[model samples]
Target: MEIDYSTIKVIGFDADDTLWVNETYFREAELEFAKLLSGFETPNKIDQELFKKEIGNLPLYGYGIKAFTLSMVECALELSNYTLPNATIEKILNIGKNMLNKPVELLDGVEEVLEQLSKKYRLILATKGDLLDQERKLEKSGLTTYFHHIEVLSDKQNANYSKLLNHLDINPSEFLMVGNSLKSDVLPLVNIKAKAIHVPFHNTWAHEMVTQKETSGKKYETINTLRDLLKMV
Candidate 1:
């Protein structure tokens, strides 16, 4: 079956790994966190527990470096049997600070793709994370002017996308989303009768990953690079 873009009036782009480096920093921070707690638990165990902690805290903390930092602190305390040193705690805080302060590195062809697409379609940014952090990265990326609207979503699900489309006064068939996360960016839009293009990043956070069974019969196109979007739409 052929997916049509003829009715697409708005093109939504995901930030973080879609437009810039994100998961890599988290991966790096996890490694550092594991090293900090190596005395109490092995690196592998620390990694597993931290992932669980992050997921468990999602409802309360939402998402971002600040939330991740808190999870690290809690995990450390538990892993250390509440005997974690102040110095180790401080190091954990620094991990989050460093991640927050890290530079935004845009993927190749991002600007080129946005510039071309914006001319023919209404471009909007739809990303999920801490509002301030996403705003800061957008400012740093220097791609803000291309977006007609910027949405920092609490989460990306079918309902969320449906609400967004409703707010825009557009039909579901008229919106198309492009992102690296199939779970957040692709499936929701697809499920809502909207179109989506998957532009995979090199690394995906564990939570963002979907199993083959989840994508078995999903109708979407996966491109190797953002540059490929130029030819498709």
Candidate 2:
């Protein structure tokens, strides 16, 4: 089935892996964290346990480096049966701090795409993460000026998107979301009657992965890179 972008009045971009490097940092941090706990478990087992802790803690802390850091601490304590050394814990803390302080690296053509699209459509930053961290990255990204509205969501479900579009007075048909996660960015919008374009990141958190059955019949476009938007919209 053919879809139309002519009616799209607003284009939403996912922040983390969409406009800049984010998940990659988390992956690197996880590796460092696993190594830190190697005394208690092998790197592979440590990684598995940390992921379980993260998933278990998602409801309590939501998503972001802070939550992830906390999960790491918890996982370390649990894996070591609470005998983990103070130095190891400190290293974990430093790992999270380093991730937070790392410089923002924008993906190729992110600026050009935003610059071009902002001229014709209202662009919004519709991403879910720690509010302070997201704001910090936005400031560092130097792309904040392109967004007409910025939203830091707790989660990117259908209701969340619906509320954002409703507040902006944009009908679902007139909103298009571009992002890296099919679960968070594509499926939710498509379910809400909005158009979506998937620009996949090289790495994604396992929690965000959806089965083929979930996306098999979805109507949306998938582009290889952000620059590809120039040709589409």
Candidate 3:
């Protein structure tokens, strides 16, 4: 699976861990409740319970911070069963605010790689999560000029990928999906008969960590840093 970088038109990037730090904020939120909530529930349990409750409500509110924060707040209230005070809700809100305030700390060499890549390929940003949060980070990072299109989807499934390809009017064989999540980025691209480069992140959110066979990993190329992508792309 050799590629001529010159022929690659659109390079789609995953936002969270691939470009900047994300999971740290989520961890920080859980840690904020460790002292008070740990007596009643483990940190992992708290996150899982919140996530489970959120999943059930996703159909109603959809995705983004409005929904995510609401889910977190709702979960906290549910587990505490009105026993939690106003201060607890305030604490969760503060944590959510902090998560929203995360700076766009791009990974090492991300800017340089994107700058160079922009000269050759039509870069596109394809991310899922809060649209406003994503936009704010992108603006602060000043990476918007490099991208021709910015796509913030509610979720990245096979249908999302297929629809994107159709909208772009590009064949799957001509596209390359680059991101940190193997489940969301690499395998999904491979499933669509497209190529993907997995750039592993040091910190993977519990929900995003992926496990696949060595054979499955073969279709995907791995790189330690975004700069390493130059070798293939």
Clashing pairs in 3: none
- Cα lDDT for residue 136, model 2? 98
Candidate 2 per-residue C-alpha lDDT over 108-128 given as tens digits, one digit per residue, 9 for 90 to 100: 999999999999999999999
Worst 10 residues of 3 by lDDT: 209-218
The true-versus-predicted C-alpha distance at residue 155 of model 2, in Å, is 0.2
Identify the superior model by TM-score, candidate 2 or candidate 3.
2
- How much lDDT does each candidate structure score? 0.94, 0.94, 0.80
Q: In model 3, what is the error at residue 120, expressed in angstroms?
A: 0.9
Root-mean-square deviation of Cα positions for candidate 3 versus the true structure, in angstroms: 2.3
Query: Which ranges of candidate 3 are over 4 A from the true structure?
Result: 1-7, 62-64, 213-218
Candidate 1, residue 66: lDDT: 93
Indicate whether candidate 1 or candidate 3 has the larger lDDT. 1
TM-score of 1: 0.99
